[model samples]
Target: MAKTFASQGDLAEKHTSFTEVGDGVYAFTAEGDPNSGVIIGDESVMVIEAQATPRLARKVIDCVRSVTDKPISHLVLTHYHAVRVLGASAYGAPQVIMSDAARAMVVERGQEDWDSEFGRFPRLFQGHEEIPGLTWPTTTFSDSMTVYLGKRRVDIMQLGRAHTAGDAVVWLPDAEVMFTGDIVEYHSACYCGDGHFADWAGTLANIAGFEPVAIAPGRGDALLGRARVAEAIANTADFVESTYRPVAKVAARGGSLKEAWDSARAVCDPKFGAYAIYEHCLPFNIARAYDEARGIDTPRIWTAERDREMWAALQG
Candidate 1:
């Protein structure tokens, strides 16, 4: 029998930890599951990355309530992904923000992505029934935008494309803290299905240039202090490079998708085989990397059918 999707078998609950990496700034992480960040401003709060469903989002809300009573004024999504944005309704923030490219993606392939992701990872969408619909951004910026909650200033900028075409990172300059969504993962695998492999490294470099004192990564534990922050960034860069280099070489030589998969496994398995979601993400990551290697700039829209077809090709 064919193997099941790694995530479908991952029904076990992860112990969620709410850690305060910076003063008034918190990270809500559930083992290797999706993570959310809270930036408490003077009078209100800004949340980064909503969970997959209302039920899961409520867990983050509970963590937020545990710290402060400030109402969420803005819901900032780092990228346009079902796992990151579907639970947005639960936040009830007046201003839902995204980069212009990210908003365009929502208009283009949001629904398809939702259908595809829901089929891949059922455990993340615990309260699928409660999801209102596709999440839309009420506010969007082209390059960068700064929002002020009373006296506190939060800068949201798209430094470069990495995990997605319109990936954004939240920088708290005063606190020297950063909330990076999927751009940097400590021990977890970087989901590169919608990634830009060539540009990912430059994006990581842009993030490192800021020299953040603390970083709330997209997955894994929060990185506190400059040393840990640097370590995660370097590790993420290595992961991105390690996956792309071998696959690109195979594609560059006109190898088939299966060839690319074998090549990637030979390199990524030993280093990242034990990472969270490694198996689930490998097929998609290899598919995208193969396309990128062949000069496919824009990632093809992934529908549920396409996901399974690719999985069977790689896993069969």
Candidate 2:
């Protein structure tokens, strides 16, 4: 029989744990899956990154229920990815926040992304019927916005584009913890399907200024201490560097995207072999890296049809 996905036979569903990173800061992680961060303020709460579906998002709510009774007022999307934003309706956080660029991306390519991603990873969206529609952010900012969770300060800064053109980080200066959305994937592979390589590196440097002692990355274990935090950033940077350099080098030499893919595969296939979705991501990674190397700052929309065409053109 073919292997199954999403449903982990190891652990029954509805097992969400709220891990306290600091006094009021918590991370809601499901059995080794994508993580969501919660910041409890003087009154209300702020949630970062909605899961795949409303039903899946409720799992985070169940985790939050274990901690406190504060009502969640804001839902912040780190980027415009379908897996991260589709579950917004579950929270009903009043204000769904994202970068202006992210909102624009949703307008431009969200439907295509929905189809493409749902096709790519069926397990993530286990309860697909629960998804009402494409998630839209009612409140958006071009660069930054500071939300007062009663009295606590949460700074939303869009330093530079990395994972996506509108990628942003949730930073708590006093606590010195930042929720880097897919910017620092620990165990999972960085999905460079719509990434900007050079800008991503610059974004990493920009994040360094805050010097977050604890970081809740888009995936993997939340870093509870400083050293592990730095390790996460360094590891992310190394992966980004390794993936892009070969692609750029090949593209600069007038080689085709196919050649770039092969060269990048030679380097990444062995090193990043263990990371989840490494194979599924390589073709898109090579495509984006090649485009950036050729001076394309903004990545093009990735429709489901375009997905297969690109895959076949580059690898098939």
Candidate 3:
């Protein structure tokens, strides 16, 4: 029998933890699941990456309330993925921010992505009925923007495309801490269904340039200290390269998609099989890598139909 699609069968709930990575910077992580970051400035709060549903987001809000009563003034989206942005309404933030490219993607493929993802990961969309359509950004920037809460500065930047064409990161210069949305993952599978493999490495280099003392990655435990941060970056890079390189090689030889998928698994499974969501992301990641290797620069939109078709072709 064919394996379940994505995390559809993952019904068990994970244990969530809220950790203070820096002075007022926080990370809310749920074992291998998606994570949210919080930056409490002098007066207001900024949340990075909303959870999949309003109910899930409320948990993050509760975490924020536990730390401070500051009103959340800004909600920053690292990319345009349903799992990351659908819960924005729960925050009631005045400004919802995202990169220009991400905004365009939402306009283009948001609904399709929402449907496709909902079907793939039913557990993540706990309160699916409560999500009011798509989550639209109130503000968009081309490359970078800065938000000031009193004297504290939070630099939001689109360093380069990696996980998605519009991937962005939040940087705290003074505290030397960074909130890297799926741009970097520690001991978690790097979902590359819409990723740019080669460019992602360069983007990681740019993130390293900041020399952040600590990092709140999109998933997994937060990395503290420079050494741990560097290790996380390296692990992320390795996962991307291990998956992309073998698939690219197979495609270069005019191999079939299944051949490419097999090649990627042989190389990546031994190294990353134990990572969270590794099984769920493998087929999608391999498909994207194969397309990119064949000179398809733009990632094809993944509709519900396409998702099922790909799963049947690869995993079935």
Candidate 4:
């Protein structure tokens, strides 16, 4: 999983893939890097998350163009991660939307996240020079909002905080499908540096509340059928819980961060080793989980320097 990171000077250059999860929805993934979801409505289109740059985002747009010519009217940021929202300009949508809390995250740490993620995973940002700037949401809401593309109804709701403080999901009630960004990753190492473990588990239950026929998780292959979807949710929950619980116990016992990291590695790596980015993400996930379990409520800002320090200590 060393492939997931690079220094600030490095940049991402990887192949991409697009798969259809439903009749009108698509998931764009790159070697288990961050994933992007697209939903085509009756007369327009909605993009769930933007790539790290406009140039990279256009690849997904180009693929969609091969199937339909509907104008992309909305770009919905599932959260404020730079890899997910910085590509908004490429969509050229009339409105860029996200949860109100998501917008706040952008204001609070969008710039720092940009630097933090660029340093952590340069392979995910293929065309960094094309980035316009930190992405800002043009529209936002508190709990839930419904958007109509002609007669098609798409429900966007902030189910609860999981991956981030402002995590949200896009649901197609009629289609019985949902786009759960990072809430349910299938066979992928989840990035939990800024996540809330307890809240995240509860949010997964909220997503299960929809009983979606299929779910496009933030990473890995899209899950189809009720059983597969449930597996996705449960698998991700297990990853998150296993990443936190034992490490938290170690920390609570006054174990050093390195000791906590080692314990998590011994436990989680065996269980999730084959999963994508398991090694690259484990250090950060363990560190943050340890901190959160010790009552650090808000996630600390991750600067480039901090990223290297943490990596050298835990993974180098």
Candidate 5:
């Protein structure tokens, strides 16, 4: 049987887990759905990466309320993906923060992304109608910014282009906990549709420099120790290298996109095939890798129409 395009046929529900990785830091993860991190400060709370919809976000909010009643004062978007940002309205945060690059992406392709992603993963957008439109950042920074939840200091830093042009990681310096938004996926497929394959590896190195004691990755279970953290980071890097390197080699030889995809899959599927979203992300990841290998620096915006055309060409 032919494979489904993206996640169009995926309908099984995933169990959600809310784990407290640090003193006041929490990770909200669904099987392979987008994850969110919560940091409770002395006076308020900062949430990283809102889920796809307000209805989905409420589960995180409920988890937050169960632990602490602190007001959610800030919402941090690690990048400009619709599944990660469209739930901003539910937080009622005065400050919605992201890197300047992310803000620019929101302006450039936010709507297109919203439409594209929703079409790809309808389960994630259960309450799509409730979305109040694009989630805009009230505050944008160039490189880094810091927020104080009383005495607690959470540093938001953009190490380099990885998952996206504006990828950011939330670091709690004192607590030694890092919320690495899709920059370091553990046991999950790295979606390279909007990724920078080369830069992403370097960004992972930067993340390693922090030597976090605990890591709240964008997906999978939280990494609780330095060893696990190291493993997750290395696994993410390996996945990227394994996928992009093969595809790049094929593209350099003037191979067709399908040829590039097959090369990448041959190398990746043996190892990463069972990983969450591996199949869903393969086509798009290969498409982006093909473009990058052929010298396309900026990733083209993926509208719903573009998604269908690409899926048809690749999967048919």
Candidate 6:
């Protein structure tokens, strides 16, 4: 299984960075692991994207304590991914929020995803046992909602779908800063196993319309300037298109999944090989792209058994 998931052997710890992207906005990023954002309001704080487990969540809590003692009033999850929402219990925030579509996903395949992700990458779930169970949202919105942290007005909106069906972005109108869950990544592979390839570019356009000065992306470094923000958005769009186009072409030609995989590598490796999680996400991305090209509107649920089966079949 030479083409097995690289994350299986990626157990080394990544160095974490806490960067302030706005007046009271912070991005807690670990090398290229899942990132979390903190917004300190006049009276309380709001956190975006909980880590994989309570143990991991505590690391974010530590960073919040370093700057302010304000209690965490809300924990906003960008999607229903296990690594993003399973740590919700740790926050103890009275209001846990997500998009209404995200909540339906949690009820649909949340457990399977938790099992699949835990089996695929154990390093992220450092304290798996501490996870109470599947995380649920106390509050949900259809399209948009606003939460005020004293004077700081944070707008949470489901701006189309890219990484997942229910991707949400946290925006600060005053600071022109946004916390984009996984809709955008900086120098990190965009995992598209459950993504909407066709709508991804449109979503990028929506985010670009806001002209954010800074962004705390789902992974990688915090974008601090308009130049960097623009670059990341453009690069993310490029990555999504690059992965989908080649694989889609292969499928349109009636090629097998393995053939589609080869086509994707031929185009992507030279351009994105240096990115974090590039290898780990390649097989899944290609599989989904192939499916989408074949008119699979909804992505099939990924289970632990299916993960192994696909890896074995894709093995070179």
Q: Give Cα-based local distance difference scores for all models.
A: 0.93, 0.83, 0.93, 0.84, 0.92, 0.92
Candidate 2 residues lying further than 4 Å off, grouped into runs, are: 1-17
lDDT of 4 by residue, 31-143 (tens): 67678888888888888888788977888789879778989898888999998888888887558988999988888888999988877666667688888898988889999
lDDT (Cα, tens digit) per residue for candidate 6, span 131-195: 98999999999999999888889999999989999999999998899999999999999999999
What does candidate 5's lDDT look like per residue over 208-288, in tens digits? 999999999988998999999999999999999998999999999999998997788889989999999888888889999
* TM-score (C-alpha, index-matched) for candidate 2: 0.92
In model 3, the Cα lDDT at residue 99 comes to 94
TM-score of 6: 0.98
- Between which residue pairs do clashes occur in model 2? none
- Which runs of model 3 end up more than 4 angstroms from their true locations? none
Which consecutive 10 residues in model 4 have the weakest lDDT in total? Answer: 1-10
What ranges in model 4 sit over 4 Å off? 1-15
TM-score for each model: 0.98, 0.92, 0.98, 0.94, 0.98, 0.98
Clashing pairs in 1: none
Which prediction has more favorable lDDT, 1 or 2? 1
| Model 1 quality (TM-score) | 0.98
Q: Over all chains combined, what TM-score does candidate 4 have?
A: 0.94
- lDDT by residue (218-266, candidate 1, tens digit) is 9999999999999999999989999999999999888899999998899
TM-score pick, better of 3 and 4: 3
Query: What is the TM-score (0 to 1) of candidate 5?
Result: 0.98
